[model samples]
Target: MVSMRSALRTAPALAALLLVLTGCGDSGPAAYGTDDRTITVDHGEKFTLKVPANPELGQNWYLASPRADAGVLKYRGDREDTGDGDGTQFFDFTALSRGKATVKLLFCPYGRCHSADEVASKPVPTATGTPKDSDQEAAYYLYTITVR
Candidate 1:
């Protein structure tokens, strides 16, 4: 019941489709999360940082360090908030040059963080000073990135 002619015609079409689906040998940028030890990216490549957040409850994540400067990473866009209830915040960035940069983020309740500089200046809350269960202050997450 097999037809050699039909198989041959579909083979070339399937091969072309496969190439498109596989991106035609294009490898995109890499991504990393808070748990990653240290992130490394290439200049002109994009990267993302995702952190847990609950905007509905007035808790959100804020970028806290490295004000935009030449020869360093730059914020590509605003955080993309996703999910319901406790969700995640996606921060996108692009490596501008070959250098090292530290990214600090803070998770603060509503009215806590008005600016990145304000958030960066404050000390990371301590269990003793702001008991973990306390409904005051904010928490921090830091990541170091090297661009090549």
Candidate 2:
């Protein structure tokens, strides 16, 4: 009877502790995928630009080089997660210095993008270039970032 009383008294505390622990993990960098036009971060900070992709339907993404200032930011790489059926592609980057840079994300649907080499061959987009929305056939998203 004494042991049962102790367990019952501590059960709620244990449950709360477990809940806090479960939420602790590498949640990755802050995402700037929404309506924010400018992303600001501290020097040496990391951030991710996540976009939807479904390669089964020929939906893909590619990072456009020369669009971003390498002196300000470093392009870490790209990745994909299709486990949830709704595919997602992410571009990881780290702020290198205190300056402004623009990251160009290209969306290619229906296999319009032949290969990475082809995308690489495309000329760099001018700073004033307009980025098309993803719903269109080929869309370009320009993200301006400032690191302090």
Candidate 3:
């Protein structure tokens, strides 16, 4: 039979081993969609915003504006599709601090319809280089993120 003192001594070491094993696993990033109006994330956590886009048709999504003063979020990177041809665009971000930030994405015929300089402008330029015209309009997406 095992002594009480021996079991007590082994319990703590077993508990510590379990904690190390569980904490080593990767849970991956959290995902959000367009339907989600707002998202809440913890600081240092990674998250992804998936949107519908078709680069082959010249209709693509690009980051138009990100909250510069908030300083609570950081843009990691992005990917176009996952070999499924579902026209999915993945935008990655990391929560840096406890605050709120807004991300704006514009869907338009980027390369075929506008110049690189035009797309890089603060307020994204219209497709036709015209103002207030339906032909120049592009779809817009806005996401508000709150980090805690």
Candidate 4:
């Protein structure tokens, strides 16, 4: 059995404990992935993607802006066997549409291929929309990535 005074004394401590367990302060928006290979952007916002100028099949990377014609992105490899990142390639999108856009991390094959050249790609998770910013109508998006 607990006395009234003892219960009262532990009340504040219990409250603090609950807060810690539940997490204090703003947690921001819900994250999109279990890993750090995420990419996100807003309409009219600029973003950058870095990929090895040369990568083998099954190698994983990021791609963005597949739906919009002006912002479509792709990757290409070096012509020769240059081991250096001298083959490092980048596909950046300066202007994207203002809505939910789907992006794919693709396995773009190199070398001479057919007009029906095959490329494997997977859908990368994303949630894009225009958020109210000040008085102006603008697209807003936030993306987080971690590299080991």
Q: Pick the candidate with the highest TM-score.
A: 2
Worst 10 residues of 2 by lDDT: 124-133
Error of 3 at 65 (Å): 2.5
List per-candidate RMSD values in Å: 4.9, 4.3, 7.1, 16.3
Best by lDDT: 2
lDDT of 2 by residue, 43-147 (tens): 999999887788887878788655588899889888899866778888899999999998877777778784445766665333333223434456566788999
Model 3 residue runs over 4 Å out of place are: 1-27, 66-70, 82-84, 109-137
Candidate 3 lDDT at 43 equals 95
lDDT over C-alpha atoms for residue 142 of model 3: 70
Off by over 4 Å in 4: 1-37, 55-86, 108-116, 120-148
Model 3 vs. true fold: TM = 0.63
lDDT for each residue of candidate 3 in 1-148, tens digit (9 for 90 to 100)? 9999999999999998998888866667988876764899999999998876657656566776544234798898888783555477888999999998888766564344342335554454433222123223564567788999
Question: Which candidate would rank higher by lDDT, 1 or 2?
Answer: 2
Every candidate's lDDT: 0.70, 0.76, 0.69, 0.37
| Per-candidate total of colliding backbone pairs | 0, 0, 0, 1
| Residue pairs with backbone overlap in model 1 | none
Q: Write the per-residue lDDT of candidate 1 for residues 24-62, one digit (tens) a residue.
A: 877654656556637988899888887666677666777
